[model samples]
Target: MYSEKLKYYEFFAGVGMARAGLGGDWQCLFANDSDQLKRQSYSDNWAGEAFDSRDVAEVETTDLDGVADLAWASFPCQDLSQAGSKAGIGEADGTSVTRSGAVWPFLRIIRGLAEEGRHPALLALENVVGLLSANSGNDFRSLCGALNEIGYRFGAIVADASHFVPQSRPRVFIVAIRREVSIPAALRTELPQSPWHPQTLLRAHAGLSVEDMAAWVWWSPGAPPPQKDFELEDIVDLSDDADWNSEEATQRLIGMMSELQLNRLAAAKAEARLMIGSLYLRMRPNGDDRNVQRAEIAFGATLGCLRTPKGGASRPRIIVVEGERVRTRLLTVAEAARLMGLEEDFVLPETYHECFRLIGDGVVPAVVRFLADRLLEPLAKHAKEGVFTTINGRKLA
Candidate 1:
């Protein structure tokens, strides 16, 4: 095994959750993000590491001190998300694209690193599952093509935080290793379905076939152990004496519900035992006239996806039904943090909205750690074996 610490560069490093997932062995050589608030959180937790608060497009290879063992980026998903405008990376005129156009800068940086002979041995990127279908799979194909052009072999896996935590945060992780280190043929064979090698991803994006992917690893340690059945109560902070929403506000939300949602809420209220549920307001087509807002309530063991409160529609509201009484309130920031797989010791900014936004935008640490153990750790061992040869025909370590 390599004795020297593995260095990493984190892009779009919101709150350093990905760094946390890489664990103690990997040293972060550089970190960058555009948001001031997110950078604050990163500095608070990772004061020892070097952090650059600059836009990715503006950053150059010279700004980075050296090449890293791995480069991780969780680029913005606003443009790729289903809820947002499905702009699909924009056109030549840049009129139709969303902010996700920022992803191009990430690719530019990677290309720069490759051209300068400082490309990381491995590259990891995370984004929403919608990315698989963004632009009808062309975007994904383009991404793979870009990596392939840089002399790296890449594969992808979809990991949901629900497997490791109560939250149902599903993200797509793309891992690329330099072509010099060969991948076993047997490991590249397609499988029916797996926790790590999800069939849905393969089925959805034909561009991810074995032939298209230079090296694809399922990246699962083994069959995932059964997950614990968690309910809303398991994560809610019962100790916090927070006030419920005003009666008028609760009535207004109820007034906006559709017939189906009303029935669901009524059924939960009728139950003898106290029931906890989550609700999100969404714009839906009304009876043939216009789009109207409706409260969609889910009565299940898990909370709905946590989101940045861009508006009332994106905010998550909690519904408590105790016999004849019904109450509603905003989800506590602490609960949101727990759902994101962040530990209790992790510090949060004083502003509640910022906390919620950071957690919503952050990656699940558990999922990252799992990938590290199954992918990066093994690659480190391989690198220590001195088997990796650079594209220039130079041996690595």
Candidate 2:
């Protein structure tokens, strides 16, 4: 079965979350990331595995052990995200020259593999949903065009982490198959589907050249496997041993909230059982349109998407209410890991910041597994049978 249960290369492989999601069955031939803390955590959890800690720019073709059945890359999204600088990976003509430009190196490695006739049968890219509109949609076109130039047909699915976890993170997965690999028509839809193909995605596709559109497939991976509701309260660490904030600190947090936020907290406090809430301090406009810091809390159901602590407010604080008492604390590394769909046994970074950043930068494993079960497995099955589809584009370079 596709070289005995599929093999993959994990690029920009932040802490091997993709590998964790893919699980033990899929052999990981190579993995690379530049972060020291992430490298340490990844090595700890995935010992005896080939883990390359070099920056993507420093990665050479020889570092790759062999041709993989798939390559999953979760490249940097800071430049493309609103939480960071929205500078983006530049335009179609050139990409970001900074570290955020890691996607280009990722593409280079894939292209290099193709040149050596060792290209993987499939490639999956995960990044912030902002990729769809980054640089006014040109970046999306460039990515699609690059795959086309390398002789692959591709599509995108906007998978939200909340579907599989209690975190409200929506990421875009650009799943591509080499032109020669046979994908059944069942995976394609004549019309764009909702949720996966949002209006922004449709607009991005319409802006593409006709040639790229022809190479495009509106991937229909079917509804995600029915997952029971994963609520904010379900994954939280509510025991007293948790690093709950002190009485003074909790009161200070409450003091910073606006009227609306206080009302939400009051509503949550009125609930029949203990309440779990997540808080994020953000810059919002006052009556005069002047920016002011405000505390915002999501009372139930789901927490806002986790973000690395680029700023103090970027990290979320958790609040708990039981009877007449309330407590608050920074999101613990353990809770952060669970929010990312990591099991309790998974080794995390040593410090809170490191672990939080690792989890924040990671993709949800359960979501990945869901996609693997429905989309990737079928493609591999078709590949093993020598099911063939012809390429309509000429290979470049």
Predicted structure 2, TM vs. truth: 0.91
Candidate 1 pairs with clashing backbones? none
What C-alpha lDDT do the candidate models reach, one value each? Answer: 0.77, 0.80
Question: What shift in Å separates residue 347 of candidate 2 from its native position after superposition?
Answer: 0.4
The top-ranked prediction according to TM-score is 1
**Segments in model 1 whose C-alpha atoms lie over 4 Å from true places:** 91-97, 184-189, 197-200, 207-221, 311-313
Model 1: per-residue Cα lDDT over 33-135, one tens digit each: 9999999899889777678988887998888877688989898877778677766666424455457666777778888878777788888989888878888
Question: Which lDDT value does model 1 have at 274?
Answer: 68
Regions of model 2 farther than 4 Å from truth: 1-3, 91-95, 231-234, 287-289, 311-313, 322-324, 387-397
